[model samples]
Target: MLISMKIVIISSLFPPNSYGGAEQIACAEAEKLAREGNKVIVLTLKFDKGYACSTSDAKNLQIIEVSHKNIFNYYNIGKKSICLRFIWHIIDTFNFRLANDIAEILKRESPDIVTCHNIKGLSLLTPLKIKKLKIKNYAVVHDVSFYTPSGLIEWGKEKSWEHMGVLTRIYRFFTRRLMSYPEKIFFPSRWLLDFYYKNGFFINQEKLYKPNELGFVCENKSVDSGGKVANNFLYVGKIEHHKGILLLLDAFERLKPTNVTLDIIGNGVLMSEVKKHAQTNPNIKIHGQISREKLPEFYRNAKAVIVPSVVYENAPNVVYEALSCGVPVIVARIGGACEPIIEGKNGYIFNPGDVDDLVEKMKKYL
Candidate 1:
């Protein structure tokens, strides 16, 4: 029998406070680790208003929410100069306070292994801190944040990811050096692994693991629908510009599929645009944020789930969720989102940011 070990999950955000793919994936892994008889403790940055340090409990998970000097949690960060943002990241590159907090937590609850995830608010200095304790550690690369300040590089149209400027190169060099602190590294997609390897990341790391913690056995799906639901499509992910919300809106408007209605179920920077389009067009509806527990019901009844991400996705949990409910998927052919989907069977893959192609696919539903 496999032994259950004590595991610490460190991520930028956790469930109930998550708004992106990485956080939700972290939450799933933490919960799964707990259910498998391992002790799981989640040390995540808290982003809610008026929250200091707090503790909470889930079925088999222990959550420690740490408040920090973050751009997301504080409004003052909005007014600061762009240089200041760089400074904030630099400070956290080996943040003294962040290390101390983790050290203190370690004293109280020692873990066998620490798994790291998106550390934007937590800091890139996180793995180094764990190294000091001499514990087995590995980081899950959900984005390019470890190598670049913005985590996202310019892609689309005629642009692909390229080398950064002098300052950015310097920033990435130091972070990439620090990136080697972990004993091992984990990737959710081969594309992410390739990105890091081609750029000389974790060259000296002990081992590498991929498709991390994304596979799950879906529960029996049952949702309360007053009557038979028809021709309803679902979009359950971030509403950012990079997620292609605007493209989806354009497609829905131009095509004007009378037999179909789109249910958008997430929040992000582009929420206003989603709402604006919804107001003018009755076919689009914004449900804002909904609990994960209730999402399967939406998926169970939907004709298909749309993942119109413009950027390369490591692997989207929503895509898996949709498939688990026996719902078909309509995803962009970028990175790992297209991996799980078998075209014309469970889903269709379209060119990234192609509104007309998306519309043509939607027309098939009617």
Candidate 2:
């Protein structure tokens, strides 16, 4: 008399659609659970790019793609004032019709447990509908901002004051009230849990579960260590100030290594500034948005992958990616990024914005 649970994963993003930290975690966890003999299916939004639509079963996991149009896709929005963000939230949360469609799917499929990742893009309304349908549900909070509005404001990008404003506050207040409908809340890091606790989001800490590292089994690939004499460092994330791209560049400039080069492999609002900086310094190279498939190649060839984020990240997949590829990581000692690093064992860590410390750390590896 063992009970087998049918789990439905509701995430805003999924593999081959978009590659974000939360999406990766959802993908990995679903695969793991499926491998463990539990029926796992993913309900995710399909981007307009129309890359691949066919679904294939592997490792006992199934992925269902619900097509989505990019109307209020705030994933691209860099930063905005509190007022503008509040308005965006209203439009994003209410105007979208995806929730109704998702609710229909939930009614049809009737999964025993529903696990949600990022619902901002998909609209929280859908989950509410699932609750009305009396479905057992759970949510994984990948970032602190989901619980509190003012989480990442200090990143020097467009701020979402509106989401942190009066309207958002009202919405959050109600949302917190409805949060108890879910049986459990999963957090990738303790920092996120503590942030929510201090902000008065969850009363009982028992609801929070760590689930630290996602299941990431690296596929065996040929490694090529031989190349040109130029020593290289790698950065693999959005080109934003909060990611500490500017800080990394500033530190690289200060270090002034004649033979070392830094390769930036993502795109964002700071692209123009990063491009301008790269123009002045031939040592810095911006490769703008590389596909997820191509990321392993970058990690395989680099001296070390750098994750210099200024904000409190829940858990960065890049750190795991670097480790999986057998490449070392140099990260900032803030948030969940420090969870994997052993402070010189497998990787190195530096103060969040300390250019001098970063320079010194870079010198050790180079």
Candidate 3:
């Protein structure tokens, strides 16, 4: 018989304040564990505009939002300047105050295990606190944030280890010790796991390439003949430079298919540029970010999905979500984005930032 155990899940963000896939994945794990008769306690940062604590619909689930004393909240980082961001990273690297807050919570709850995900905003030294308290600790790598604060190095512009910038070298120096405190570390992609290994991380911990759960249930909408509801291609993710949103837009424009339409979802720094492009092109439509409940409808209505990230994306949620809906994917041949795809099979892969290569892949679906 399986005994119910208390599990503490620590994430930087959760639903209602979630900006990306990592948060959703964390929420899904917590809810699933709760459903299985485990006492799941989720500790996350309290954003300025969000509730102090989240009320969950799942039984045995409790959420406690703690304030991380910092220059600014993590969610609104895009609005801050480079100098503020640099200071934030410095404070986050060795935030003993926030670590004490986490220690107090752990002392009160005294859970069986502590699992951390995306702990940049919440504090990277959290594992160190957990270690000192003799808690069984596990961690999930959602991105390259531990090595580089930006969580990205452009697709082809990645630097060699010795040639890395001072920021990354310094960040990794601290994180390398902090990361060792975890008993085990989970990675969503083998490529990402290897990247960390090459960068000399998690040498003393058990590393597993465990893909993320889709987080939502969606009926296979592409059950019909040809598996397409319309001539629409969907892009659902952050509109950031490393996401290759501009590359996607440029490729789509160059293709200039009259019968096909492109629908963009989500919001970010490049939102204005996307809007400008949409204004000039009737075939392009920008719906901005929508509720997760409504994402299936968009996936169902789309002929295909595109993930054109220029960064080392570790198994993006969109790839799994689109596949679950039976929608084919066309992704950049970088990072783990193309790991789930088999050329000319369920989806296609193109060279990252190569507009012509992307157009060629899109032509197959069109």
For each candidate, what TM-score against the reference? 0.86, 0.82, 0.95
lDDT of 2 by residue, 1-366 (tens): 232778999887777555468877887778768877788888876665655532336455777777554344444333666666666666555644777788888888888999888776676576677788899888888886555444363443324654465665777775576454666788777777776777677565255756546423543332444644326899999888788899999989998888878989998888999999999999998898876778887777777788888877778888888888777788988877778788777779988788898888888877
Q: For residues 100-206, could you state the per-residue lDDT of candidate 1 as single tens digits?
A: 88777876788999998877667666777788888888888888777676665534631333345777788878888888898888887777787788888888886
Candidate 1 global lDDT: 0.75
**What TM-score would candidate 2 get against the native?**
0.82
Question: How big is the RMSD of model 1?
Answer: 3.5
Q: Output the better candidate (1/3) by lDDT.
A: 3
Count backbone clashes in candidate 2.
5
Would you list the clashing residue pairs of candidate 1?
A: none
- Ordered by TM-score, highest first, the candidates read 3, 1, 2
Model 1: runs farther than 4 Å from truth? Answer: 1-4, 46-60, 67-81, 157-163, 206-209, 212-229
Report lDDT (CA) for all predictions: 0.75, 0.73, 0.87
The TM-score that candidate 3 achieves is 0.95
**Worst-scoring 10-residue span by lDDT in model 3:** 220-229
Which residue segments of model 3 deviate by more than 4 Å? 1-3, 50-56, 160-163, 215-229
Candidate 3, residues 159-237, lDDT tens digits: the string is 7552287776888898898889999999999999998999899997999989876834666665324664568899999
